[model samples]
Target chain A: MAFYDSLFDSLGLREWCGAGDKGGPMTMAELLAKSKGTTATEETSALTLPFPSLDNLHAACEAIPRTRDMTSGVENFFLSIKSSLQFVLDPLTQPLSWLLDGSIWLFIAMPWWLLIGITLVAVYWITRSRASTILVAVTWLFLAFIDHYDYAVQTMAIIFICTGLSVLFGVPIGIAMSKNDRLQKAVIPVLDMLQTLPSFVYLIPLIFLFSVTESKLYGIAIILYAIVPVIRLTDLGIRLVDQDIIEAANAFGMTARQKLLSVELPLALPNIMAGVNQTIMMSLAMVVIASLVSAPGLGVLVLRGINNLELGVGLVSGFCIVILAILLDRVSKATLARVDVSQDS
Target chain B: MTANVKVSIKNLYKIFGPAPESVLEHAKNGVDKASLLDQHGHVLGLKDINIDMKDGEITVIMGLSGSGKSTLIRHFNRLIEPTDGQILIDGVDVMTLSADDLRKMRQADMSMVFQKFALLPHKTVLENAGTALRVRGFKAEEADVEARKWLDRVGLAGFEDHYPHQLSGGMQQRVGIARALTSNSAVMLMDEAFSALDPLIRTDMQDLLLELQKELHKTIIFISHDLDEALKLADHLVILKDGEVIQQGEPQNILLNPSDPYIEDFVSDINRSRVLRVRSVMQPLKEAASSTAGNVDYNDTLEDVISHSDGDTTKVYLVMHEGEPVGTLCMKDLVRALVPRVPSEESIRS
Candidate 1:
């Protein structure tokens, strides 16, 4: 270890240490530190790598042209393409913006009693179990009493829109990927980079391209971060379709489009729905992170808690997020269960 | 058309590789499947296959695994493309059809029953049975009615709404058959269609298929690895080995006069008495305007003829079809047919 440290030292990275990149650009390491606690000192952060020589490695990372050049290049790339991308994207994303804005307004403006009553009825309709439905009603009422109703409602609105958009585009792309092997091979690595990149890394390029004030900024981040599950599961669902079944469809003279609609999509519904459930949860996960970009709701409060170190504010909002997750998860999962039961019968 | 030849294969070859077209010359020149793969990178899936399937007959192609029997059947619907071949069905070359024409060919001319009962797990049995019609733009109600008729025909009338996973394997295969029948296509492809069923259920399905065939008279092409199944279902039998048809004719003829050692080995262990029809062994009609001990149908198995004769050696029987004399069968010829013929080569060598 000492020999390796000395060897790295001779590479002359010492000058780059403590250059103080104080703009708070938020590295993947900072995200980790944020998750643990928002109060880790800069000195402690230099210990991110497990090895003893990580101090030198950190300084070397800043000095390394490969690392610095790539990061800055990516940000610039996103910035340069912003205008054209936004133009092409606006029409496609307008519906998404409308859905997000419309839903948020509707959720926030509804009376507390009306909202709670509607939620209860919907939950009962799905689960048909008085017990689960009551649990839902009580959870919502608890939020109302705690004065977190608007925040919870705001979070739900974002989740609903982001997940809806993710499924809308993700399923067809996944189906296309399933049909074409070359496309699947090419697109899978892009999906992998999207998924495996640090969750916070998604916001950086969008922040550079779209102003922090734009609703589309966080909306895009939530979708890019959350859409992976539905795409993966939809692809898996279609690919896992029985080859013999496919041959039978072919033998029966089904056109490709007919086969997809009648056989592949129907058979793949359960897996796709499961994928939707995960996408919804992932959308919620991006909630607080997305709040950093001026997106509203419970996440804003969590960010407030972190910035001001207000334990009560952070913990309360975190509790509301959990409540929202469990409620959304239960509803979608229950619906998926119904689909599975119908399949079995 | 052309003496009732429903489908014809003309010098078909299937070489599985990136450049099967480039290797066609070698495969055409009798390069064996093994050497094609070992010497070159191509796998010879089928080689020089020529067959004529008549209308209203079950043409059963029999081969062990990797003999390309399955590959050959798939070519009828163009599910598997051939390297060099022409497949003409009903006097039209299927190989030349456009995508829409090909789809119409499959929808109007062919339907298939699978070995594993490939019923959609999500759709109800009725919906599955109606699938072929639904694909052809039939109204849901129209398709359902058509499917229900065949479902009843296949003895699955009341189980329409049940999903596939709810049914047993045998019952699931019944749905597969019902689906094929519901399509009302001129051609039915059964790729080892009964090979996956229980033994008792397999026999029942076979009988069901035969009963349906007698009434419908569809041009059926069946692929099977089982010699017994091939012998039982085939009206025109094509025996395949290593992607080549070794010998094919009436099953009884192949059993009686195996052209080579490979066929001899195939028929050697077969119970010939159960397979050989009396017409295969009966003497051509000699105009004896007289009565015989009994009347036998031309399609009667030799076993049935024996039981009709009641073990009497002197009894002579008239082989009839539709109450008309086709041939004469005596007890002597029946007993001789019971004995397996020793090939001339084997006898000479011994």
Candidate 2:
């Protein structure tokens, strides 16, 4: 540290690197020592550094930045911007809460049989198979028989709202990305972070920004986690369209909009549908985690099961989530297969 | 025949890299293709290309792969913009056309057939054929009626409702041609359109194209890597090597008098007797030669004349065109013309 002091001093960096009181949270060791109102015990080391080590550099030059400082700096920066973010994000996000709440109410108010009938009809229409329709019917009946139909509907409502929003916003973003290299370069890292970042890490920030009572808290968290796949796959799908086919369209003198509509989007449908299926499954996965923020659903029952150690409640609710996922997956996959068949034929 | 020049490309340079403009100077100063790429990290796609495509004739651009033949064809439609050049179509500079005008030009003036067929996989053959019309804002019904005519012309009438994948490769290419024909543009740009077909199918397509060309008389720019295809289809031939025009003229003239070693190499192994037509080697005559073996069609290949002669060097046949004697083809000159003027290089690789 004495060596670093002289080293930094000779380089004319001492003014910034010699301060002791940078206004921020202290390191864990400093915090602990202060809380105990005593200097922490130090063990003398037999081995001595031949030169200035990083620890001594931090000690002897208190202005030298530490890793914690950088993290807390990011935290402080977010805290400063949080109100403006909420101001902008809150009004924009209010409709999402309404959509979620409205869907949940609509699902619940309808008699269970009517909802099941509509769902079965929709599935049968899309898949065009009586066996799949019967399978969906049996699954719904089992949920009702177990008295978890209401909870199951709540989860489906959330997934429906979130996945719909994801596709609605995600698709255009994906299209824009596919059209522009600069935008794709800008979006890809953000998408990568959203995808690979631990789901709860994003929630930590969202929890601070929005209250648990706001439906958008869970909605936003679920969307942030679930939207990545659709956006990624949509971009990939558009990019994967045959260059020769695109050239053919261009040779016909297709305008940009005409080409996108009649050629690119139609060709990319199977991939986009696959993206939606993944988004639905991911939304279902995030729904259980979203229950930690007071999202009402079968997830609530599962959490209650976990907290109270009731194995039966957890297993049944978990099974219900699996059934919902399978229903979504099968319907979407059937639609994808249909598209493929039509294109292939 | 004094045909009007339909499409004229002049002083075109295309350098394929980040800074094509900066490298254009070097290319203009006679920096060859490989060294320019090696020194400046730029690919010389085309260098000072100049060609006049006459109306109502097939101008076959002949080259092996990576010879800028595809690049040149695309420049006509601005699919790949030239680094520097003027493309004059009917005396209007294509490079200076506004975006809307360019699209208008492509829609109203030209259509293309692609090597891989490039048919829209999702669309039925009818819809794919109607693409140019649909893009031009024709309603589906209107486009359908128009497209049906071309599809019928291309011999795919009953297959209108079928998807591209459901058809064989030859059938798919017919749909490609139908799509081009349906556009009804005067210029047809075929970029290796039949290269994907089997050899037998390719010859059939060639015959089909020639038959259609005879009836239509549309200005066509056909790109081919195969010399035989070029000789068969080209009314005017432009040979390319290393992104430069090595030689260009009538295909038979190019065969008779190849100016570059590359062009010479290209024609070296071609079935010379089969490719050389009687009209190319005939001595112009106001009357039939007094010596009489028989009469031969002006368009007949020397192979036909050779068969007619029965290997007799003294036979001379009257070259007939439209039932009139235009010239006389002497077996002695034909036999001498069969030998190469210059000895070809040894071990010509493929």
Candidate 3:
């Protein structure tokens, strides 16, 4: 200790010690006096520390305002922005509202059963399995028996729009996150919040922001609720690319842009496609919840059944949702399987 | 062939960190290795590496893992940049080149093959080979034509349409070799290119590389941890240990007389008779024709001498160097050279 003391003294470190004291521990007046090398005058008023004393904690608590709401500004800002967006989108949402309306004329214009048959056949061909194809056909026939086919198509339409939009927006964002560490850090906490939030909670604020009659009101909510898996999986897919492959690309003198296009993205395709499948399934899950905000779907029949205590209507609509889930899951999974085979070969 | 230097590196250093400039500043002030490890925690990948690659010569960098051989070779095409030194391709400093110029140099003057073959998994063999040319802005048809030619050269002519996963390890490596050769770069950097293949396939690949080297005369820098592979292919060998050059010379010279104890230990178990050629040890056949009843090529191995000769006249043979007789060695000398030396009793007891 003495040796260290002498070493510090010889190095003129005592001044640095005092400087550290001023920064860390010393009182402001003491620090000021040390800086100026002067004492306080008799007439100078004493300066008090800003921190409350332990003995006076109860008094401090009593003195502070109880109604000091800290999050008021944040809440107000969010509310205003949401309302303004809804006001701007109201006119643009009219055609979608009319499309959602269940009229005889619209039903006559489109033969519902024929459309169902065609969709089932296309799904069968894509999935390349008779069981899944027949399952889809029978499910649709049951939906028609319960007069929920039209409502089921409405739900499917919403799911198709939401899933397409989710993949389109989510994949690019995921890729961007994979490429940029700072962006990944920024996005991960938000993804965590979205994934953990109750699915029904998504519709609560949107309902206040937009009218229940608009299709996009629920459309936006369902997309927000379901888009997380795709984005996360895409990021994971790209990140999971073998580092050796990346180094090889660099050795080949491929630019960063070229490597991403030719190597990284292609290798990550299976994971990204898996993410898309998850997103589609999630979109289906959110559709029933979105029906609370007047989303026209098989969900409407389920809601009606629940409201009226009709067991048959509820069971039929629930079965219809299951059939749709299987159809989408089969098609997406098959596509992914094909991609993997191609990549392996 | 005229001696043309294809690649030159001078005192290259690579230190990884966020503040490379500050890290380098500290590193220049004679910071000891342990202290640098303590302060910055940088894995000193390559340190003060200087090498020159000649045209049409296969230079092998041999080292254990973490010896910086891969990092050192990667600096040639700017795959990894040197923290301090200059890498010159032809007459231009690659470090100072513009991005476009670097890409052009890599695309036109240099190519690389990786240990894992690094073929694009989704693309067919033809597409993988053609990717470099396509990136270099060649038209699809022209790129395909050139790719097919190189594929044929690597003996995978009919398998162009098969994807990488469809090919065997040997076949995939062939595709990798083809992809590299397709660029038509005078210099090719192969970083343990056949290390992942089975022994038989590895030998075949080595033979293929030798065959390709003969016709193209490409300046090649090969990296390997395997000593035998280095001896088989390298015109010049650089042995690295703990991020420093231990020994560097012709493969025959290094194999015969390693410079230090570390190098000696590294080369100790090597089959010297197989690696050391008669040209390295044989006395010239000037006075030897009258002395010995039989003729032996100066380039034959000592093993060959023992295996081929029969009668009692096999007492001593003169060694040759460049058509001039250099030294004389008898049957006893051959036995002495073949046997490993045992330590004396005092050394053994210690």
Candidate 4:
């Protein structure tokens, strides 16, 4: 003990670490260390597992292989490929971001009552049910009364853009996948990984790749998270097209393009619509996570409340989101159900 | 049956497998389906098929399932490309035609009716009927008009707006027939077209097809597993077994003399009197065989001739064709021809 103290004193590490002054609650590890013998255990614990510092991980990192890193070689590989990825992704995806930005601006600029009225009208058109339309109207009016009307509109805009883009890009990819076996086999694993990933994990890489200020960051994150369903369902819908119908189309000497547009697509529309419904729901669920990347929506208010530990703000915003989710779900579910009835029910 | 062949499928062979081209030589050298499948992992879909479908005649290809009858018909449109074949529709070699020409030929000269009433479920009955014309790039108005005319003719005038699922099986098939008709093609391929309907409905469909064929004289290639259906409708009958043509000729001739044992077995269960025509039993002109009591038309069924005779064994009637005495038929000969020609038990035992 004297030698250790002299060594600490000689090194002048006592001033830096504050010798013999333990802090905070004892972890199970620390308790066991204390039980081992208070003086010996603490000194040994201090030397071996001292309270965390900025370079704590680095201290023992040499014992672990770089190849077996916490952040994988795959992660590094993706980072390395970022420039090439952006080369293909940027200008091509610029139009999408612009469209989303335009929609967001439009929604924000519109009067709150007008957006609510449009929502009511849309719900009525889809369901043709008075009860459902009135419910949708009340929900919107409630959101407006709470002064979260603009926030709701922003959320709606993002959902619209993400869901629209998902269907637009996803359907064609699904069709191409169905048409070629080799491509389907190659793409399915990527889709599986995308879907099985935790929602927050998607935001991480997207955040690093694109700046937080860019709308494309959240837009891309939401799309990646929500796109799987539409692609799968479209592929399934087309594949589920009756073999006899396909044969009949072939017998009619219809062109490949004609067959797809006239027969296959019309037949697949109901399934594709159902896919869109799922995509929309997912986009809405992703809103809270998306708020972390500076997405302007009700999710932003929810995040703010959490950051500042304001219970009232968090609970109210969260309630508004729930109401929005329910209203959107009902309208879309009814619409999808109506489509299914026309097909085979 | 006529000399003017509308569609001639010549030397057709369809080998079905991953590597059919490699096994073509072995198949052409008389390798059977089973042996080819066992030895080479290839199954023969159609083996050296040859058929000349006559213009304005109902040519029915009769076979049980796996007989390549459907496969053979599909080859006419090249829907299932034959491993080796020549499909000549009119004087033009169909195999030699480019894709555009083939599409043109399909639009202009040929149409098909499927077994399952393969009407587009989303399309209304009228729109479904008009699909062929629309595919051929006709304006909607003109196509609708053409479709309306055919739909009326097929007894579906009142159900124009009904979807396929709303229609009965018979009505759906009528729509299928109408769709084929509206294409205004000279050749119609009906692949077991009425097989999916109920028995009564099937008979009605068959009668409708016959009535339409008589008036329009469209060259119809009908496929069926039922020998009765084949005999009832076929002017020329083609029988197939295990992807090869067993026999093909005039339907009456096929009933009278099935060359193969498989065919004999098929014919054994048939009721002969309804199927045998007067021309089949008629003899060369004999004054003794001629009768003034009634003149039987050459194409009349033997049952009709028998009814006219009223079981008078002495009655000998002149067989008339287009107001000309083509032959004479005696009651005895007619009775003898009507007898069921069941193969003896000894032959089966052997």
lDDT of 1 by residue, A1-345 (tens): 322334446777546633535343555665686889775443333445445444334433443333454667887887788889878876776676677788999988888889888888987887676767877888888898999988888888898789888999999999989989999999899999988999788887677666677688889999998999899999999998889989988888888888899889988999999999999999999977889888899999999999999999999999888888887888788878877886753
Candidate 2 structure quality by residue, lDDT tens digits, B161-238 = 989999999999999999999889999999999999999999999999999999999999999999999999999999
Q: Which window of 10 residues has the lowest lDDT sum in candidate 2 chain B?
A: B341-350
The global C-alpha lDDT for each of the candidates, from Candidate 1 onward, is 0.85, 0.89, 0.77, 0.84
* lDDT tens readout by residue for model 2, A139-256: 8899999899999999989998999999999999999999999999999999998999888887898888888898999999999999999999899999999999899888888899
lDDT tens string, model 4, B1-350? Answer: 43598889888999999999999999999988999999999999999888998889999999999888888888888788889989888868888988988888887788999999889998889999998999999998999999999999999998998888888889999999999999999999999999999999999999999998889999999999999999999988999999999899998898888787777777877788888898898887755542356788988998887777788978878888999877887788888876656664524324
Clash counts for the predictions, in order: 0, 0, 8, 0
lDDT of 4: 0.84
**Which of 3 and 4 is the better model by TM-score?**
4
lDDT per residue, candidate 3, B28-125, as tens digits? 67575567778887656666777778888999999988888888888888777778888887867998888888877888888899998888888889
TM-score of each: 0.85, 0.91, 0.82, 0.87
DockQ of each: 0.49, 0.63, 0.41, 0.45
Query: What does candidate 3's lDDT look like per residue over A1-345, in tens digits?
Result: 211334346767656544432122444554686799775433322353333432122122322221222244556777879867777777776554454453323543578767776777787667676766777787778777877767777777777777877888898999999999999999999999998999887877777777777677877777787899999999999999988888767766788788888888889989998998999998888888777888777888888889999998888788888888987887788768877887764
**DockQ (0 to 1) for model 2:** 0.63
| Per-residue lDDT value at B291 in model 3 | 61
Q: Which structure among the candidates has the greatest DockQ? A: 2
What residue pairs clash in candidate 1, if any at all? Answer: none
Give the Å error, residue B224, model 4. 0.7
Which interface RMSD values do the candidates have, in the order shown?
Answer: 1.9, 1.5, 1.9, 1.8
Error of 1 at A311 (Å): 3.0
The C-alpha RMSD of each candidate to the native structure, in angstroms, is 7.1, 3.8, 12.8, 7.3
| Candidate number achieving the greatest lDDT relative to the actual structure | 2
